[model samples]
Target: MNVTTILLIFLLGAVLTYVSGNKLASKIALGFSIMAALASFYLLQLYLANQNISFNGVWLQSPKVFLSLQADGISLAMVLLTTCLMPVIVLSSFGNIYNNAKSFYSLVLFMAFAMTGTFLATDGLVYYVFWELALIPIYFIALIWGNGSIESRKKAILKFFIYTLAGSLFMLIAFAYLYTKTGSFLWNDLVKLNLTSTEQTWIFLAFFLAYAIKIPIIPFHTWQAKVYQKAPTVGTMLLSGIMLKMGLYSVIRWQLPLAPLAAKTYMPYVLALSIAGVIYGSIVALKQKDLKKLLAYSSLAHVGLIAAGCYTLTQDGLSGAIAQMIAHGFVIVGLFFAAEVIYRRYDSYKIKDLGGIRSQTPKFSSLFLLLVLASVALPGTYNFVGEFTVLFSLYQINIWYAVFGGTTIILGAYYMLKMFQNVMLGETNTKAFADVNWTETFVFVVIIAFLLLYGLYPKPITDLVTPSVKEILTIINR
Candidate 1:
């Protein structure tokens, strides 16, 4: 089968899961997610076998936007990340009971469907449609299913929705302008346009506004922590684990090659802004008392580094960004799940309220500690490999950039270790914090296994994305 089949699986899954009724919705969703993951692996095999897995066809005549879904190494890697995490994300929700299980699970699958299409779409208009479509599911998921003060949650999610939608308009306008110059909206055609430096700058900034808000680079990141704090744990997982990558991925996939001159011209300034975010997010994370908010800020910091790597426009930088993207996706999910586990038993996320979890639940504390160390980029963990490569790429560009970005390692260690100690160590908590159940253990094991496996032997991932990254870099430097 072709790659479009993967999207069909998720779309069909969303419908079937909803019709299965509440009692069976979660099970059906999990089964479908697993099936999708298997299908993705099959796609991976086809990719390795040098099969043609992409789809391209005419969809509209008025604007000449083709229904193009191209599967390359870079896109396949991202697709794999989305599909594999779908099952883990679905399974992670089994512990909590929601009011409308069917709708919640269905939205989860629908979001996956949209996001998968976003990664695969090769036509500019088609990509934007999937991009916008992805936002809709999360809006309802967080707004309807989220927790906290009703007024505050609504405020946060709405601000996020409006703010991002506004940014996307600029990208739409930029695409419209490009369409005027070139009659086609296909990626190959768009990248071949020889725009002036001035034109490239505006186009770059247009795309930057859209990506930065989604990536939420400093000055634009106000919406993230609040939304993360308010959303349900599973919603939080989906946002931090997968949605954020969309912006970062777009930077590599669309922004750079499409505006190579601007990328080069503004390299220093953007790199500075990204590295600044690294420090900013880390320090903010350091002061956070809420577990989810802390993890949210930590995500902001980590993605800043990933964005920095992308802007470096080097093979190492692009490849490292992808590696880190995958690593952060899994690690962050595990960390958030650990927070949910603690909240499940202790009914709290405040660092002040949690202590001595290790004394009560050894298995959970061990897994939580591993996740914490992974966040801090301790060697032998997947995070360390990704972070180091990103830093190395920064170093090649400017030592100062590397120096500033490297603070994530130190600051990350300080904040994460401190959080772990406050939340998991110290006096035995009086609350009866049960160890993780089989499902929880399964999720943790799956994530940790991937992290450890890839951390030590990263050649598979690096190799998979290298050729695509090289090709993209060629277009950017052409």
Candidate 2:
């Protein structure tokens, strides 16, 4: 797990930020993100050099449990994603947040640490702890600094916290049952214990309930829209861009392989729900006047497709699902940041309140246009590659599913272009508006570059993930 390196870096960042006071907190957080990035790079190099790494002794060994920390290829990929996004997220929020900067930045770093631990933790108990820990900092960040009416923000955060926690309780029970059967909390130990089909069914449902609420397929998504709408832009970015992936990742890492027969038995209903989310989310997004709310619903729709892809149980589907997860993370963050730029300038998120932005803020308009194209899966954008691969894979499962799911692109384009036309190119609404400043320009440029670069050269990511995806498929097929 490289526990020493991971924990040392995380603790050092938290302590330094806490003691440095608020004025320098942002700097400290940025510095820590850079350090984490470098460390992640070094860890990747080490993994490449060694191909295997582990640190295991005994943190706790009791009659019913043994705690261990472990990392594998999938965990490492998630760690890299977390570390890579931290600096960017910090930088994106820099000029945007002013009051109590120290607490804000410190919470950001702590959240990163918790998320990293959640991915790397090998023990079920440790995973659950980190899972809940990751939610705390974001809760306060949103509650304290988020936009919208104070009452609404409070309601949104409370709903998000309660809904996820309720689902998590069921997951905890599932873990307790597994511990009872195996007498260990370690993942490998749990994986080795054989349970009957009925037992696996109940346990898998418990875990699925927790993750589905997080990934938030159709009926479980009532809390997500308000949370994203009320939370601060950066908080929304974190939740939509990264935190949601935790649920999808857990589905792959724990549920399917852990209870293969149950997964297969329930796959049809899961797929149905995912498809419904796709159609329903897109339809609802079309009616949203608020840009953030629109994007939130759009995200739900995209994730639904990814969830369906995951359950397809094909090599292409699994690989595409993983690729789409990363692609969506990047695209959605960039999109939300774009929304923040407009809100900052016009002081409005209402689509009707904006018009003819390209006449004044050419740079901002162009960037927004490019992102919109990417969001709708333009051929040269990263999303197109993911969408194509996902649909192609879904085709193997059922052609009707692919055909229906393909409507998302058409629906996405309808709303995305409509939003673009309304916001960027109509009657000039304001007398004058400024283009993107240096910070805004830099953020958009980086996001666009990755979108284009990965769109053209997806092979690298595909190669890095293929072996792991293949291994997962083997487990499911077993």
Candidate 3:
């Protein structure tokens, strides 16, 4: 039940999956991911009971960095996220085919391993190590197995790789500076330093550069659409479903807590940028004819508000951001999977050709419409709960911020509903269509059920995340 065990399971599972050979690879990966997820829930229960599901060892004596993996309330939430989405991600691929099945599935498990370590690492160096470790498997996954013309995919993936890698370097610099200040890379030690306002500002920007590129708040988001369009459905799922949360989670876990003064000083500008991303992504999504690209912009808009909420530095804001992260993770995966299903049948992503699918496949259309409504933050859905709380937090700081941020509700509905109309509701497609098979049904059912259950009763999650959010707020307000 230790955090170390959780990491080991995913890593071991990944290696075993690679060795499982082609026939058994996907099953091994799926089984391993599910086992890890259920085990994570057990560990989460232990964590909630105040058990010590943590491990630490001296990995580098000279640098004084520890290979520490600890699960707290916050980390537990994130670890659970990484585990929960992983199985569904794997299951979503059960019906698809790839040239090198073993390599592709192994990469998925490896990506989960990296992401799990990222959430569980307590040492700054280890966290950074895990952070970059995540990029490797995904790079190959997209580069080797991704979709689109070979040349076009190559350009898209390289831009994505370079953009994120370049941003990560700035974060490395900041962490290096932090180690110099504290003589240690431990979270506890780093949090105790009394740095000057200027130093904090620099550190804040260093972290901001990395996170902004990932959460991809305006101007810094150019890499996303092309990458999403080019990558395979599974790669796109990994990116939007969970990888984006790495940045949003870091904002709560590292940035604001470490550089409170800088965060406060720069709040106005950050809000403007984040809110601008909200409007910009929404408007662009409104015009996108390509389904995958449209979903990417939609993700950008949703996460922009999540980033804005984190910057608010309030209990409601931070906690709401975490909830939204979970909600968006599920909703986006389902949406992208829906896009993939449509693409499989038509071999095209252009919205114009996707017409009157509802007339043919009522079951898929109904399911898709439900997910679309959830995405638009319809009442009684988890997204609505997250969105409302975040907007309320924004209103506490500035009424106008909430007003502009609120446009997502209106514009989000406009685009998602319009896309639904175009893709699922128009003229009946000329090609015969197949609805969700058992595996796809399992994926959608899990997503729909969780969103509904949580949407109706968010108190459990709110309670779980509140203490951690409040602790971070205490550091920020100090």
Candidate 4:
């Protein structure tokens, strides 16, 4: 009934999952995630009905940073995303034999706890704590359970850890500066500061460095390809599906409103960079022969458009970003799970080593192609709604900008279809590629159902988040 209930569910579930012996750990975690997700949905229903579902308490009295958590329409949307995806992500691991199943599933639940907290925390200091708290479990997850040679895995993990932590330092410094001006770490106080243009510009850049690295926009994305390739499928899912949105969501909630003038001032250059990432990621995806790496670049392309939409600073643009974030979360999890399926059957992830899977595993091929179409933003799929709205918002800004941003559709189709043909539609590989089992089928069914259902009628989600989006816009315009 309260926001704290959701966080408590995940946190307590994490401990209980660890304690539950290896034989039942995965199931326990999966059950916990499903319960939490269902609970979060009910809470979102209450929030939309204008009922208050919040928790506020003092953790520190001197400076008065409260252990406050609350949900308006926007935070619930993100919380729903984190909750919904955790169950699916946990479900995907049911067949695999992890070395330390208890620890692995426990970290998965713990990460969910931190992410939900990040989405719900209204106090700036509490939000930052959850933000940095997320990095801990994922770092170990990748380092301990990830696939690759020790040297390669260590290098990738270290680079990712150092890169992201460095970004957090800048965010912390910006928060410290803002606290001096307002004497409080509440979001309400920060947005109300009458900062001069110089202060706004500097603070904007500070937050920009933090979020951009997390979102992994073009120039800052050096860590993405390597990390994604080296990580296990679950780690990749966490990084791509939910964690990346943390950055995009932060921009809407914190960066833009707190530094409105600078946000407007720097949007042009930022849009150009974001659009550049769209092009860059697509072009690179075309050349990638490794399945995981190809999807990595593809993710980069799609997320670039999401980032560009955020900078468009329009109602259509911001709402479209949220839709795309949720849509992308599901589609990417499906795609990565598909890749894992291919690997398990064929023992290889290289495109050259894969062919004619469709001939043998017709069921998987059918589902995968649908997911591929969704990724390319085909109409009647959820991504199409988000992508079209985003480009339309850019068109309102400038026709040339829209034209450039729109290349993702064509380029995405080219690379996605090309990968599909090369891997799924050749002469049958001289090896077995069995169709997906029941659990895998269940995973794909859940993902596809969400896409099609929302694709047919997106009004519910759009209506739910619009008020919150407008409130952020109102603060920015002030």
Best by lDDT: 1
Q: Write the per-residue lDDT of candidate 1 for residues 1-478, one digit (tens) a residue.
A: 8999999999999999899999999999999999999999998999899998899999999899899999988999999999999999999999999988999999999999999998999899999999999999899999998978789888999999998999999999999999999998899999999999999999999999999999879888999999999999898988999998999999999999999999999999999999999999999998999988999999999999999999999988998899999999999999999999888898888888899889888999899888888888889988889999999999999899999999999999999999988988998777778778999999999999999999999998888899999999989988
* TM-score to native of every candidate shown: 0.99, 0.96, 0.99, 0.99
Q: Residue 262 CA error for candidate 3 (Å)? A: 0.4
RMSD of each: 0.7, 1.6, 0.8, 0.8
Provide the clashing-pair count of each candidate structure: 0, 0, 1, 0
Q: Cα RMSD (Å) between model 4 and the true structure?
A: 0.8
lDDT of 3: 0.90
Worst 10 residues of 1 by lDDT: 427-436
Rank candidates, lDDT, best first: 1, 4, 3, 2
Per-residue lDDT for 1-478 in model 4, tens only?
Answer: 7998888899999999999979899999999999999899899878877888998888888677988897877788899989999989999998688988899999989998998899988888899999998999898888888888878989998998899999989988999899888888888888999899999999999999989999989799999998888888999999999999999999999999999999999999999999999999999999998999999999999999999999999999999999999999999999999999998888788999999888887899999999999999989989999999999999999888789889999999999999999999978899888779999999999999999989889999999899999999999898
lDDT of 4: 0.91
What is candidate 3's lDDT per residue for 1-478, written digit by digit as tens?
A: 5887777788888888888898899999999998999899898788878888899899999888899887777788888888999999998988788887888998898899898898878789899999999999888888888887888888988998899999999999998999998889888778788889999999999999999998899899999999888888999999999999999999998999899999999999999999999999999999999999999999999999999999998888888889999999999999999998888888989999889888888888888989999999999999999999999999999999999999999999999998988888868889988877877888998999999999999998888888888888888888
Q: Tell me the tens digit of each residue's lDDT in model 2 across 1-478.
A: 3644765676689879878988888889889888887887787777767654556566665644434556666677777777777777778877675687777777878888888887777788888988999889989989999988889899999998999999999999999889888788888777777789999899889998899899998799999999998888888888988899889888887888778889889888888899889999999999999999999999999999989888888888877887788888888999999898888888889999989899887888888888889988999877888788889987887898898788789999999999899988989985567777888888888888988999989887787678778887787777
- Where is model 1 more than 4 Å wrong at Cα? none
